[model samples]
Target: MKQAVVGYKVQNLLNFLVENPQLKDEVIGISEPLAATQTEFVMRRRRSLQDEDAITVYLLGMEGTVAPLPLVSQVLQWQAENIKAFVHSHFPGDADLCGIIGRASQCLPPLRKALNATQVDKDEVLSLFIDHIDALESAKVPYPSYYSELLEMVLEDGFTSEVLHSKLFQDAAISIKEWGSPRQQQTFVAICSICPTATARMLLRYCSYDDLSPYVFDYFDQRSVGSMIEPHTYLTIRRRLEKSLSRISSEINVVFITDSSNGAVAANASGAADATFFSVRPFNKPVTLDTLFVLDAATISSFHQLRGGGVSYPLLCAEARECNSRRAASNEKRKTLPQGAVV
Candidate 1:
């Protein structure tokens, strides 16, 4: 009769043998929730049994998600004891497991030590896992029932790839390209890619010249060099536009602004400031003054007379500049009283 041989992808090797008699000399399993010491034991065991027969090999789980550290540790530890070798899987595309494995690798020194120990041997453990998974897939073994769910979790939570590719982000990018300046577009893209959705929104909503200047300034002071303006800066600029309009005009029935890219910045002014002036300052550029003008219901109605009813940034900039020039000339005229001499 063949010697009863039980193989496990992970050890506590003796425990597995004690639990199942049929698995005796035939049982093979892999480790789970891999840690440092366990991985060494596995590697060692496999090396010692290189010449052994009647040993079965087992590869547990799918590729990418395979627990490597403990498995490697176990193999290393058992090499001295002479255990047979078995293949293992690594689910590389699985983000959750990859993150877990990454974190584990960082936090556990023992695992790293074991991996370094094999440096002289030039064994590529990760490559081995990948090869094993490929071989298993080619062999047409049935996948586990939970495989899809595990993959989904990894994609959604472990990595941000799904969120970055989401429709919301794509739409925002498209809008920015269409209406925002190049700087604005780049800033928006960076925010969408790097920030959590809620945080990004908050940054846009709060950081502005009028509402939170001090806070915004402080934030910039602390950021990494060359980082783009935070969302809060955009929000502050929007609020400043709203407040400036309120102070300058009374006919402005409503005032609102949006990212043009994000379609998110929106506000309405009523009551005394029913008619309003709105302006947008593209990132890294001075505000366009020629475009500023009073907006009223009648003005909006007149705008509708044109092919497209939306307000135009270029038109607003022109009007704002003209208005400022007239104001400055008026101030000059007032100061002309001194030309007579002293009084």
Candidate 2:
């Protein structure tokens, strides 16, 4: 009965090859001797042996052909352990592996477990993971969450792939929550920081001042050589730090500057007093509009000197206007006088 069943299967296979002339030509083109191969098309199984054997035979017959594209999805539908050997053995080329790796989310759970159990196909699978990391980073995969297990595998192997590090940096920049757990975030940071410049710049670009300030300081103190950073990156970080400090200062302290004699209030960017000019006195409480008066010449001159060319004249009262008039007259007289004459 078993011999008749084997003969029947062989006859059906011959009939299939005859019906498909292209597949027949491919089978004839096989250069490698199938008899010398270590793994057989059949394996010992407890049940459904016929079904398993059929899948193996079908996969082997379709080897070295364009049919693996559609065949891969079918093989992926089966148990990973059941079909992984055929996948690694028959579809060992780059194109085939890439196609399978692109659907990593669909097959990674079981196939990853199977691959992790054996050292034989680990390198090939890891290479695919490193090469096509972008595919894993895309929307198809849920990013760090889905790949956390794979990350553990890579970490265990003591291997670093630059692109994987870049992806982790990008994911962390988007949201630290993308790493799922606090432990994962810490782990990712440890790995991602290997590419320090790229990781630091990405965090600087996307993270809030409160979120990234400590990292920047830590990078400078611990990681940066001689505390040196790129000019643009350094300036950007400094500006953010200054702005953050200014916000905190404004919240904690309130100082209103007013002219001692006329009580003219000077408007500054922040409520904190300008310690540079000593003519005005700072009050803790808000000054009423009734106490408002125009700024004097000394105060205007002091404010302009401190603020540079773009000083606003909102507080310029009658006294300031007259001072401007005198300054204009002096400029006109100087233009009319001889080159060496003093105004």
Top TM-score hit: 1
lDDT of 2: 0.27
Cα lDDT tens digits, model 1, 1-343, are 0000111112133233323434433432231222122323333333333333321111111000111122212222222111111111223344554443334445455434534563522134344333433443344333332322323332233113221111111112223233223332111111211112222223222222121111111111102212112345334433443454444432212122221211111212212111121112111111112211112111111111112223222232233233334434534654685543211
Q: Looking at candidate 2, what is the lDDT of residue 74?
A: 22
Off by over 4 Å in 1: 1-106, 114-165, 169-171, 179-343
TM-score of 1: 0.19
For each candidate, the alpha-carbon lDDT, in order, equals 0.25, 0.27
Q: Per-residue alpha-carbon lDDT of model 2 for 1-343, expressed as tens digits?
A: 3322322333233334434535544643331222111011111111212332211100000100111111222222221222233334334454544444545735556545544554536556654555445454343323443243333332222113221111111112232232213332121111112122322333232222224322322222113321112233233323433354453332211111122322212223221221211121111122232232222112211122222322111121122333334445545664797764422
Q: Go through the candidates in order and give the clash count of each.
A: 75, 0
- Give me the overall lDDT of model 1: 0.25
